[model samples]
Target: MIKREGYLIKAGLLFFFIFLEILSGRTIFLISSFSFFTTCVLSRQPIRQGRAMKISHQTVVNRIIVVAGLLFSLSEAYAAALLPDKQQKVNQEAINPEYYQGLSPEEAYQWFRDAFSESRKSTELFVLPETEEEISKRATIFNENLQRIIKENAESVSKGESLRLGITAHADLTQEEFQNRYLTLQLPAKRPEVLPELKGLELQQRLSALPDSFDWRDKGVITSPRNQWFCGSCWAFSGTEAVESFHAIHNNMTVTALSVQQVLDCTPKQDGCKGAWPGVVMDYSKTDGICPESCYRHYYSMELSCKKQLIDKCPTHIKVGGYASVPQGDDKALQVTLLKQPVSVSMEASSFWFQFYLTGVFKASHCHTPAKIDHAMLLVGYGRDSHGEAFWLIKNNWGSWWGQKGYVKVQKDKVNTCGISSFAIYPTSI
Candidate 1:
């Protein structure tokens, strides 16, 4: 009876040990430990209470079981330590180019296949709620907005000078009609959360005092208009533009158009092809000098061997800064100032705008709609019509077949309209 009781106690302890191991993600070790423990338990028998007990057999079994469990647990702990942590894995896969670069295309393809297979296997361990309805709603909204954009920007598309595929226009409205309709659209009336307030006189004084010509442009500090393509890398584009302009103004030469591809490929400080903030790019560029267009093309396939050594040209021209903060009612002054120099700006684009060409003049509505604002472009200049209505000179990249040979003029200073205000700027050196 004593021997039998001891065996049962040992079996119970082994079961508990296996349970702990399983809970801690050691499935293989738990299985082995449980099997060994069960065999030890089943092979033992109870001895007569008063008779000499087979103490040696029971003692050896317990010793073997305990030692095996300890060894298995230790091995599991070591393996767990060697495995990459969650954060490490994420960094390795997404941000670390070292892991993916230099591999043959076929090898890279195989790596992705294996990685995705493992990911799918792990995902099956969790239960997810149905997202069908939410997905359907988003699809509907996207389709509706796309159709509206195509219909409204039809004239612009027909002209075929700009990337008019992803933008929208007000249907059946002349530029004047669109402006009038925009004033009545009852959009959100929230005040600008980030701009500084400038009184009217102060704004006028600043505008009047502004130089008629900046030396930066003569130096070649101009940015090429960029198309965001299918990626949301506006933040990268903005940062690159600011830096390129700064280089042009200070160096007393034409602003050398820098490669956005360099920022997209090299800067690990922020999201790559996905959306990133301008501030992050600014910070990263300070330490890592800009790369030339020949070395780094916009697409990965265009990347050439980095034969040109990197140059450490920190921004020495304009005061290095981030985004601009213009007051709510100061759109006119801001536009006037921006017209003096090229500016990089962000806007919400409709899907249809991606397919059509935009020409003539457009009165933009304030960006309060549900559409995601993922596009960025350069503001080349602005002008006023005989009727005293303002228009913005904008450059776009969908080649030279769209808009007015590759540009569009948008309405300026109308509340809740596009081109109401501009964003970041790099002043040209006097």
Candidate 2:
């Protein structure tokens, strides 16, 4: 009877093994055959007469089966822990880098001229209207502003040349009203600063320190325009630019696209479309976190409150740090550091600074002028020009349409004024 009971228990143990293999999506052929052989061996063991064996073969078989199941389950659990989670599918169009690339240098110059002409034509249509009262009002104001600017700088504008003013048209105002209002407003002339001669010895030393080879595209560093569209969120855009570069360098991740709305709506310390510092923005990411674009659409305005739950929790692999800034008088050391780590920088009026698309040996702007700076950007890398003059290769946020297709090379140490010299960096992990 004891021997018969042992045989029944062994058979049950073999069936349990088969059940586990099927559930785990593993082949049971080898394990099942081995179980059958082991069961047969145990079942054929001689049964002692009279007093039953203290440890019945049935009890031994049941213990072995449980142990085997536990071992397999543990192994599977370990493997699952090692695997990376799958990323959600995102549209390639949404994050495509090529969308940002601009025309070749020659083609870009032509595009800029064409774009400027087109803008002037559009402004002309709005400046002159059929209404007599409106047309007369606009003409008076327009003539006054144009006369003032030309009178102030007659050399810059030729006789009979039309003066182009930068102005935005609003829906509430008629074309004539908008033009009149714009012209009446005081428009300050940009005082061009004449850069002093930089010491050749210092410049040469800086040039020697830069790496000879660097591929900007492979490094995921490119210039963009300084964009301002109905919002004073330059701070949000600046912070996002730094975050994007840091992710690319340290995490080996590149998303040419980042939402300014994410910074505007989500970060509590920052008022939506208002302004905030990069430091405050980083702190928000620690708590609310950042989500992929699919999870959240870009939003602005006080009417819609940001939902924090949409963002992903911080990844264990990524390391966070404060914005990196270069130390004063350590430009050479800073240049070496930048080659290894990209940093975020803020300059007053980077918009106009990048306007010239100045390259090779060019004059630097002195700070004596009325500053139009209210922007920040990234310092990706640096290299020497054909003449062996050093230049800081910078990326701007203005669309690819502007400035050498969204890039500018500044004289290395010329405009290191107003702590514009500072840059933020993420430490590398080996």
Candidate 3:
């Protein structure tokens, strides 16, 4: 009877041990090993040594307790390994235009506010309206842009155009406000008497086997686009990018950023935040030489005065020997120049279609002419889309969140779409 009672207690303890192992969420092998070990120990006890067996049973119980404690620690360590570190943060999802598809205007507005406004706490690109009146006004503007997006998509479908438009970061902004704040490229009041014309047998020799598609980015001559914020410093961004590409191409090195801030601060006759011409930015590089970004950091909201201290401290990596034009409105020349290096081009980007462009070959109905070019962008490459429509691949300085990852593909046109082929120029690196 004593041995029977001992066996029952041992059996119960083994069952409890197996139960705890199951609860621990360990592997099948571990559970089986534990069960086998408990069964072996309990079954190995002699029924002849009755009192001694009872004492052994108590010892087994103590051993089981110790094993359970170790298992608990192991399980906890395993779980901790699987969990993400508290210090490691997950990145926010990239903005997706498709999320708004098929939703009503009201629903779309709610979605936009949830996505952008909530993120604004950390991003600072957006701000919640402080007043009820301001909230109402912003909602109205957002809905207006939503309507434009719908109409634009419908037109693309009806016309069988490859272009697409969607709600962008600027969805709530009015065309006038977007233009005034973002489109700050100030063209010269009149054309220069003698435009610096780039001509050489070497350039002609390099143009012989122009590929059907060419991208300086693929060749590792272009850097990621930088955002200009509300500053009209597109001229400096575009010119600096061109110089970087020129230096990389000539020196067989990867492209890196020179200071757009240096150009904005030191370039003569150019308003820092209001606007500057791309030509003057390039000219500044040739004469004064722009420093690396580490030397003069860019502050998009406000332009600081040129500091002699920064110039004295940071050395300029490369200087432009000079710059030359591609003859305004010459698409063919622009393509040929792109074969040699990325070129800086001025364009009109004030239209709502241009401002909210998402992807595909962007062809707008009311795009401005060459004379009305109000924005400067880097012309990086040219290629045809899957639909056989040719496009000029240009990089915008509006940050990675805008456009197709800080780039836009404008339709290639003999008439110079958006004045892209207009005012195109490239720097000659020294």
Query: Candidate 3 on 77-145: residue-level lDDT in tens?
Result: 455444322211111132445676788766766677666542233222345666878767777898788
TM-score of each: 0.46, 0.47, 0.72
The Cα RMSD of model 2 versus the native structure comes to 20.4
- Cα lDDT tens digits, model 2, 1-430, are 7667755665665666565554433344336546454645644543232354477677567556545654564455444333212110111111122221364433432332233332222221223234767545544543343333234334323533221112111222333433232211111133112111123465456557566645345665432444433344555555566565555666665644455556667676445544445544455544444454334544332214665554443232222444433453345545655665565555544321132222232224423244333445566766666656556666665434334445555556454542345433332222
Q: Poorest 10 consecutive residues of model 2 by lDDT?
A: 86-95
Q: In model 3, what lDDT does residue 76 have?
A: 47
Off by over 4 Å in 2: 1-209, 212-216, 221-228, 299-304, 312-319, 350-363, 369-373, 386-389, 413-419, 423-430
C-alpha lDDT score of every prediction, in listed order:
0.47, 0.44, 0.71
lDDT, model 2, position 345 = 55
For residue 411, model 2's alpha carbon misses the true position, in angstroms, by 1.5
Task: Compute the lDDT of residue 345 as modeled in candidate 3.
Answer: 90
The digit string of per-residue lDDT tens for model 1 on 159-261 reads 5523233322121123332232222111122322343324566567667664432322343556545444334455666667766776555456676667676
Highest lDDT scorer: 3
TM-score of model 2 vs. true structure: 0.47
For TM-score, candidate 1 versus 2, the one ahead is: 2
Prediction RMSDs, each to the true structure: 19.3, 20.4, 15.1
